[model samples]
Target: MGDSVTSRALALLGAFDGENRSLCLTELARRAGIPLATAHRLVGELHRWGALAREPGGDYVIGRRIWQLGLLAPVQSGLTQAASPFLHDLYGTTLATVHLAVRDGLEVLYVERLAGHVSVPVVSRVGSRLPMHATGVGKVLLAYAPEEVRLEVLQNLTRITAYTVTQPARLLDQLRRVRAEGYATTGEEMSLGACSVAVPVRNGETVVAALGMVVPDLRRQLPRLVSALQVAAHGISRTLAGPASVEWK
Candidate 1:
């Protein structure tokens, strides 16, 4: 069906990226491949529906309404309900950035995060999205992700760093290793000077999310970090039925 969709509608929501937090209508339409008239109509609809906000200079930005909806999502409310106290305790006790994420489409979406006062900074926030090949949570999520998801992600791999795993066969083997080892570790794949450890949180046989911790000094902190992360993940798994029901395939 050839729907009469306007580029403006696409542009209004397409402006958000890791680098660009907000943008003007002109910028949006240009980026979305839409005309000015179409952009106006779609932008108006988005504003009325609270999907976009109008700034003082006539620019449109992602609205808080979207964030509010995310708050209601079970991954945020339900999962966080079980993960927050543990995350807080972990961060408080170890001075690290602790995070929980789930595989959403081909990316890992941060559902919850807790941080110590003085820890290594991370790019992820409660709604931030990251690729499955470059971060600790990403690796864990990808490892347990559905077969179709795994294939699709492997087909479109974008090597973000020298440490980023780009070979499909290799990644597949690593996923197997993660499953067997019950945890994952990455050294500066997402960013230099940062290393992370992650473990799966299961609901029956299906992995619904992953828990991770970031440490700046990978060489020295890894042993203790991996142990702490494994403990936290096991704690989460026990509460949520020990293993997930969704098969890897």
Candidate 2:
């Protein structure tokens, strides 16, 4: 009974994600696969414990406590902090939406982001996990990932947009180029109007993260964006390799 209650509570929490940030009681119960009565009881307990909050419209959202706990994560506390300055500098130079991301199993988890003045349609947010095959940062990380992981991801190439790389052979070719050229680029793959370029961030020889930038178009400024991303990525790598790197663990 205790275990069942715990799983149900966890399921309720898991119902919220980058896309589903808020939900009413019925929606939460439906998504969580629990009875409405059970959802109500669990949600009330969670709300009292500060694990969830009710908005003015009465929809439930992840509470401040969840965010506070997320900050304690190594990737969020260390990598994000180490890369914050570099991200800001890159954003200042390119005036483009910049991202710092890490491979989280089969997905790319955005750790930090700097919004640009450019009116590009950016969908990623801090703490959001996006498909690894649809974004520039995802491509870079996937290129460096293990063979089994790559195979698993390749088996499920969900098409995000018309331009997304759904063909395994083509994506494999692109991943090879990323390894050889040391960067990745995408054209309206994840979103319709946005294009992106990314480079790997390493701690010594191991790729630990990816730094990416999004713009309206990459054809005109691909080289410049790649250069800026590489510079920022290298800086982050150096910081992670230094004595301050202990924070990352």
Candidate 3:
């Protein structure tokens, strides 16, 4: 791409992720590889457009406009709307961190999150990008993702933790199990002491997103957690229509 200010500004937003959700002007400039002046100009425009908001501490965080814009994205909007009420109910019942995620290339994009009151504190926040093989939701989305998409994730493999599935053959088997069981579960695979169960929300035959809940302990919580996840997933699946779905036979 040519060296354009617009391109650079977009790149700056891309630099923010779950781990680095907020950044000062200097940090944003350095991360975006632009000069301070250029960063400031772009950031000012973004602020005006409501894409970035200035915090009291003076760092910039993704603003409500970005969140609203994400809602306008067809797939994300449909999936999230269909899942929100059900997710809210799940949160009320389970008191765990509930997340709705979609596959974004080789990463899992958390599109929605409802923090459950007594649930395990998860690293996931809305718009967070997490490794596909590590988290339950990511794994569930990957499991039903097209074959080429699966290959792409495997190609970008990183061993995030001892429990992260790195062996391609093993991971493939796990995906198969996820497909059969209609949900996926992991015990501290992504974060130590946190367990999660996820189910795919299919629009007809094609899986569009994954909904999950994180629990502090897994030893005695599998049955109820899995049940809630399945119910939420099914609710979202039933609400989807149009061309992006599969006719599950």
Candidate 4:
């Protein structure tokens, strides 16, 4: 069957991903595999409906409406709701930035974040997807990921900071430790002057997400932070496994 209007419009929105967050009209049309004129018309409708927004440079980006709609999805809403109170409690106790993330292909998708008043340099936002080899939560997710996914990520460990583990063998060792120790830690790997510790959040026997915290340093308080993260993760896991839990996938 020929493509429908809904499919064509959906294609235009799907053209924007983690890497291609902004695109010109021509680029969007090409990526969506539609005629420029069709794209122009669909783009106008999307922009009018607040599904797309124009940047100051005239490029198009995903708009707030999409985000608002995304928040209603079962996966995001279920996981975030289950983890929200625990995240806030962890932040209150540690006074550090807390993050709840899930593995999305070869990256870690931040589902929720509680920003602390601490001056640590954290670049991740609630909806941001980051590499699976640099951040603490990323390492935890990667450690638990399927072997093929891990192999692909190992091939391109693009260094974000001087401390990022670009060497596949070294990263392999870290993943092993993450699995054995039941937690993961990163030292200035994703950003300078920031360290993180994360624990896996398991639903039944499977790990569904990662719970993490970003701080100025993990030297003196690594154990404490890991303990706290694990506690919150366990709480979330319990909630997810309960009968009243919402669908996370």
How close is every model to the real structure, measured as TM-score? Answer: 0.79, 0.87, 0.81, 0.83
Between prediction 3 and prediction 4, the one with superior TM-score is 4
Q: lDDT of each prediction vs. the true structure?
A: 0.79, 0.92, 0.84, 0.92
- Model 3 stretches astray by more than 4 angstroms: 15-28, 36-67, 219-221, 242-249
Question: In model 2, what lDDT does residue 189 have?
Answer: 94
lDDT (Cα, tens digit) per residue for candidate 2, span 114-184: 99555699989887899999999999999999999999999999998999999999999999999999999
**What is residue 226's positional error in candidate 1, in angstroms?**
3.4
RMSD of 2: 2.9
Candidate 1 vs candidate 4, lDDT winner: 4
On the 0 to 100 scale, the lDDT of residue 37 in model 1 is: 79
Better model by TM-score: candidate 1 vs candidate 2? 2
Give the candidate number with the greatest TM-score: 2
Worst ten in a row by lDDT for model 2: 240-249
Those runs of model 2 whose alpha carbons end farther than 4 Å from true positions after fitting are 1-3, 57-59, 245-249
lDDT of 1 by residue, 1-249 (tens): 122474446545766776776787777777777777778778888889998887887777788898798677777666777677678778877788889999889999998888766667587887789998888889899988888989999997788778888888888888899989887878788877778889888766788999998888667777777787777776776765534522225
Tens digits of per-residue lDDT, candidate 3, 1-249, equal 745877898989987986798999999999889989989999999999999999999999999999888768975656776777888899888878888999998889988999844557587878778998989999999988888989988886677667777788888899899989888888777877788888888887788888988887866878888888888777777767645543346
lDDT at 239, model 4: 91
Please, what are the lDDT tens digits per residue for candidate 4 over residues 1-249? 336999999999999987899999999999989999999999999999999999999999999999899878976778888988899899889999899999998899988899956558899987789998999999999999999999999999998999999999999999999999999999999999989999999989988899999989889988888899889999999998888876547
Model 2 score (lDDT): 0.92
